[model samples]
Target: MNNARTSWLSRSPYWVLSMILHVAILGWLIWYGPVRNIMLERGKPKREALIRGKELEKVIEQMQRSVAEELEDRVTLLKNGQDRMATNFDTLNAHFQPFEENQKATALMRFEKYAAALKADQESLMQVLVQAKATKNFDIASKAGQEKVPVMISALDEVRRGVLLLSSDETIAQMHALAETALFKVEKPLRDIGSLLGRHRRLEREIQESKAQVKLLGSAMQASRDEHERVKKAYDELAAKRKAVLDQMQALRKVKPRNNDAINEANEVFKKLNEQYKTDRKPLSDANRKARDNKYQFDRVNKRLDECVKAFNGLNIQTKLPEYLQLAIDNLAEASALETQVIEQVLAATKDQADESASEVPAS
Candidate 1:
């Protein structure tokens, strides 16, 4: 038994050494391999998460800057448009200055002023849009979603209200008036020219009749010759009168209404009519002596008729005509149509803005 015990003790030392080495290797592996690897793997995910979070913050900041820039650009465009509209109104108002008639001219002036007002309203709308953009930016920047949306919605609502005011019928009426003024101012001169033309035609007919009378009288006696001379003298006097009338008509054609392109065109028509009068008058004045003698009485009547025709020709009828008159009507119709279109656009935009604003507001 003693001998066996001694041999087992001797082998125990080797077993102990083997166990110790195994434990040391296992400890080293836990400290430097799996445990450390597990810790490193866990920390890697945390570090990656932090980097991704920073990247997301940068992306959000870039988006905010882009949105802000876009908002600023849009606001600037809107302001520029408003300013242009104001300039247009100023031009239109200056055009109204030429009107001698108080009633019509005053109406036109009022309309132009209203157009200016509409432009102001447009500016107001732009301001509202700016406010909305600011609020939207606030909401986006605020990571807390609940607080941001409502503020943005309120700003949008303000924009809607501004748009609604601009689209009303009252605003449209002003636009219509502006157009009517332009149309009326244009047509006034045309009507005067038409009247002058009518006068010229009458004078031409009388001159023709006098010439025919001279032809019927065919050289007969000394008395007839003397009568023919008298007729010629009378015809000369009439020709002078006709020439004066034509000169006056020509002068009138050159007269331009201030700021009205349509009136300018009507004035041009008058110029042509005056030219026709001069051409027709020259022929009658240059007729043969025999014809003049035969047509002496007729020539005098014709001369008076020519004078009347020239007077009528100088007067513009389009301006003189009623509102419903088709031939010489002005741009009022077009202006009214444009006004309606603007109103409709404003209304639609306003409604859309309102809806969007409503959508943004949180439910009570």
Candidate 2:
């Protein structure tokens, strides 16, 4: 036994060494001395970083050069501007002189001559305006000085051959009297017509409202009929379920009393399994419905976006939107359209399933 222990102990060290050597080799292969591809990958990010750093340095140098050149240009411009301003100051002088008494008198004489010319121009312009009113075309250069109204007094008023000329105020007052006489003649009949038209409009609106009410009542009647049919169907289903329950009870009563408990338990288990199936599938159904609805909304929004893009394309491309946004939008819109078609196919395919679900009645 002592020799056996000694031999075993001697072999244990070799086994431990073998395990340690194997572990060390595995560690080296996995982590420390990995494959050549891994080693290459390890250095890839570092190489990229170094390349990016060099590119950034070049960009920085270019920016510095541009900034320095702009600064130099601006400084040269400032120097030139300062020199130009200095030259202007040295070369230029004010030429203005104050008015003398004789010059003022000469200006007054010139003003008088201008005033006479201006009066003649004003009269000519007034005649031109009257001519324009007659011809229905006003040319500013027209030199006609004809009066607008027949002008015996050489102005706005006319003098008839047999009577004293009526002033404009008297003519306006006479026109007012004529207008009053005409209004008195027609006012009552116009009022009666306006009242009749208003009543007609009111009756038309009432007729429209009545038609709307009648339509609403028709819809309500239809809804009530539908509700009645649904209720009647529900009652019939309840009666059928009750009859089935009674039949099941009769069959159970005919069985041995000991087996009745087992049968009832089996029925309870089946019912529970059905309920469980329903419960389990409820979330899946809800999730599917939500996904379908989300797809529908996505399609709608994307369709609207497509329309907007179509309109946007009509705008001036040189001034409106885009660098790459239109391309991205078009791709997304196309994808959305394909997805919508897929959803439509899915819905069409599952329509029978939906109908079956609606038709199925739960066991009572």
* Clashes (N, CA, C under 3 Å) per candidate: 35, 0
Write model 2 residue lDDT over 1-364, tens digit each, in one string.
9999999998999999999999999988888774555444454445544458889999999999999999999999999999999777655522222233345335434433432343343344444444444553322211121221112122111111101111124443343334233323222322333344345455555555545555555555555555555655655555555556556656776776547775586567556555545564544455445555545555554455455445444443332223122332233233233323332333343354447757999644
User: TM-score per candidate, in order?
Assistant: 0.24, 0.21
State the lDDT of candidate 1 residue by residue for 1-364, as single tens digits: 9999999998999999999999999999888885334444454445544458889999999999999999999999999999999889877866874452354334334434554454443344334323423453221221222232233234323433433344455664455445445434433333443344455556556656655644544333345566556656766666666566566556655677444564565566556655655665544454445454545665555566566556555544333333213222223234334544554565565466557756895534
**lDDT of model number 2:** 0.46
CA displacement after TM-score superposition, residue 58 of candidate 2 (Å): 99
Worst 10 residues of 2 by lDDT: 156-165
Deviation in Å, model 1, residue 215 alpha carbon:
3.8
Quote the lDDT for 187 in model 2.
Answer: 26
Model-by-model lDDT, in order?
0.51, 0.46
